[model samples]
Target: MNLPATDRRVLVSGASRGLGRAVAQAFAANGDRVAVHYGSRASDARLTLESLAGEGHVLVGGDVSDPAGAARVADEAGQALGGIDVLVNNAAVNDPHPLATTSYEEWAEQWQRHMSVNLLGTALLSHRAARSMIDRGTGGRIVNVGSRGAFRGEPDYPAYGATKAAVHALGQSLAVSLAPYGIGVASVAPGFIETERVAHRLVGEEGEAIRAQSPFGRVASAQEVAEAVLWLASPAAEWSSGTVLDLNGASYLRT
Candidate 1:
């Protein structure tokens, strides 16, 4: 089964680093035109764009949480790539807060940030992308990079978990609402991804514990998660919509 996404125009948020960067690279490798979005790091976004194997990879910068910024991304992506065929909302903010020690201010901040970028921003951009697809009169794909925390609560990050749960719901809602227009929406949720940001949180014994919890006996690589993202947006997954695909190595099963 060859997974070729050639000629597809994909907009990937938070592509300056981590899982977003990996996914952007994956799409570029598959010969898709990619618009790589970065929130704050222009240098990093440039680096990611330069590293792509394809010629059409472009860097876009914005705080997607802002409605104007989200719309701008859609416009730039559409213009640069000749209109977006795929939208991957992979931007997120994660800061741990245990309930007992969590402050009200901190909780509010987390919720606001998470909802702004992870939920609202994603929704707005998806809307814009869908409109473009509708105008083209051909079905398109929208893939939300969600977290396993959506299904199972994270003891230290209630706000983050709740927002991710909302992401799942948002994808489902968009799926149903856009079905008539030939647009599909789905989410890919992964657990304990191995990235530089998570390295400090999981090391030595703790890392071992996390590995033991997963059926694969290890945390997932960014490439692994990116592969799943590619699949969800690829023609291979055309029949899948409103689906929450779990790529967690069966670490936390939903019942």
Candidate 2:
């Protein structure tokens, strides 16, 4: 494992709960300072902050779907952290909007929201962080949290799958463009993770079917995904730029 330098500043977006909070904790566990970003949940964000093991961790809040909001978040985090060394794009929404059952107007709304937040928000943050890294001559890391649904498909959440697919593409493109500046870019596509948000489904009648999707007879945990993100952001993964690591538990194989 390529261990990152001590005291590296990490910015984890949408860290109010679930995988975002887990990722923040992982960074803090490694003695890194973190700037946790949340959308609108101050209470949840505070919990994340309190759960962190180290000092120098701060919280920033904003709607990633808003261009100006995203910029403010980036700036605030950079200033609070004294300069961000690693950016984790973990903020996203998976609103259900099936084309067949939804109205055209609603579909349009969902698509626009997903595209604006998942793709454009992440792109803008990456741009700002990359510029800071380049100007400071500090090689940086960018880890995007994508989803296995991007490849396997989402019948009820078309926008979620589409945005994830776009995110994967964005990571690849940025990896090449930022390579010259010593910046590494990569994405992780996870299968159904057992986050608190999905705890009900995991315990519901569908639980067995979902578990059966993986040969392990279980789904991934929040910590499992967080571990992968930590690895991708490590200095040892410098050569792993442009890679899209999948955490699907062999539920869906790409040929």
Which residue pairs collide in model 1, if any? none
The TM-scores of all predictions, comma-separated, are 0.95, 0.97
- Candidate 1, residues 119-200, lDDT tens digits: the string is 8888888888999988887778999988899888888887778888899999999999988877878999899998878887
Model 2 stretches astray by more than 4 angstroms: 1-4
lDDT of each: 0.87, 0.93
Off by over 4 Å in 1: 1-4
- Evaluated with TM-score, which candidate comes out highest? 2
The clash count for each model shown is: 0, 0
The residue-by-residue lDDT of candidate 2 on 81-171, one tens digit each, is 8998999999998889988899999999999999988998899899888899988888899999999999999999999999999999999
